[model samples]
Target: MSEIDRNQGLARQIAKNIQDSIMQGRLSAAQRLPSEVELAERFSVSQPTVREAMKILAAKKLIQSKRGPKGGVFVSPPSLDIAAQTLHETTNWLVSLGAVGLADIVGARRSLGRLSIAAACEHAEREDHKRIEAALLELDHTEISDEDFCRLEVEFHQAVAAACPNSLLRLVMVMVNEALIPAANMISFPFRQRDKVVAMQRQVFSAILVRDAAEAISAFDTLIDYQSGIYDIALEQRTLGSRLR
Candidate 1:
């Protein structure tokens, strides 16, 4: 093998070793890693190889680098945004490949939405309420475009998800919302439909504000049912257009 190939292999091995250490809790979050020269000495490799390995770990978000004194490579802390983004990307890929369908997405959303409502009702604080209220206020503006309305809809759901105490559940809710919101925007919303959507949002918010789990769940179901109906219509139209073609 060429010298370059050998260096690449060594770098991958070094990166794997560090990843294993991080995953197995041998290295804790924010723990600084050895300098390039130190790691090169320990791994019996050149400094360039160790630097390449560090780059790999950085791309995986397993480690971070700093510039100044007191600055070096450190294990990255766990991040909900990163986890949710990964999940969203994977879910979108599945939908594109026809491995997951609109029905499946809707079903998952319905199930998760109920759970979020229950948790939010129990654990929502003043800040969470304020976020939901802010989204609702923007949504109530009748002059807003459908694009703005859809964006606020996402903000509103995310605010509710933020109110949930379980980090894992919140992460999953973020993934589901990210996948569903774009699909939801494909259906054109007439003025009447937009008003209905806003009314349902109000119902859900009111129930949440009062910490009423049952009412919130009911309101959520109504909202999901309305959305599902519109999605079904959009799918049918698309299918029919293809048939005509």
Candidate 2:
């Protein structure tokens, strides 16, 4: 019989070792973990101890279990909640540095985009492809002044980021897209300019539909470049107004 100190909340050491293995990619997403009997032997603990350790990992939302002939513990990829929390943490880190402006956020987003685009190209799913189409159709009919359009823009990007193979990278992409939607609407632009903004979204979505990752990424960059240009214009206006004052 295997020895185990059951009074303890499982073996913290055993749990940590398993957790570390997952984090270090010693185990990969969807990879099967050993059976309780196997794990008990490997960790030198009782089957109950291995069970406890698996529970700890499950509570973190890091691994999921299935049953049957094919049943076993498998690595859980990041869920939206996990992905979003990771992003929010990064955003908070930047905020700690000082007052981060729209331009600063945009720059960080562009740098992050390179990673997101690459991952999306590698892992986009069928439903994600549908998400792009749905977002675009909504935008196509949305009133120019509709806040719903802005919401769709954010939704579209979130879907795009989620398509990425790396859930962690999608997290920052979510934050950046969230950052952009509000800024995009804040400035008053000519009707033509607004149309251009809508057109660009369509362009990027189309690129994604075509499975052209390079074009999709470039389209996003062009959208940001335009936003940067507009932000600079807004700054110039503020400067002029201050001079008059």
Instruction: List lDDT for all candidates, in order.
Output: 0.88, 0.72
lDDT of 2 by residue, 1-245 (tens): 23445524456777788889888989888889888898888877788777778787887778898989998889887578776655555565665554666667678768887667656666777898888778777767636455666677677777778888775576667777775445544542422265677688777777776677898788889987887788778778878989999
Which candidate tops TM-score?
A: 1
How many clashes would you count in candidate 2?
A: 0
How far residue 114's Cα lies from its native spot in candidate 1, in Å, is: 0.4
Worst 10-residue lDDT window for candidate 2 reads 183-192
The candidate maximizing lDDT is 1
Give me the runs in candidate 2 sitting further than 4 Å from their true place: 1-98, 142-146, 180-192
Candidate 1 lDDT tens digits, 1-245: 99999999999999999999999999999999999999999999999999999999998889998889899999999999988887888877887778877788789989999999899999999999999999899998889987888888889999999999899999999988887676556553532387788899889989998999999999999988888888888777878989999
Q: Looking at model 1, report the run of 10 residues with the lowest lDDT sum.
A: 183-192
Stretches of candidate 1 exceeding 4 Å from the true structure:
187-192
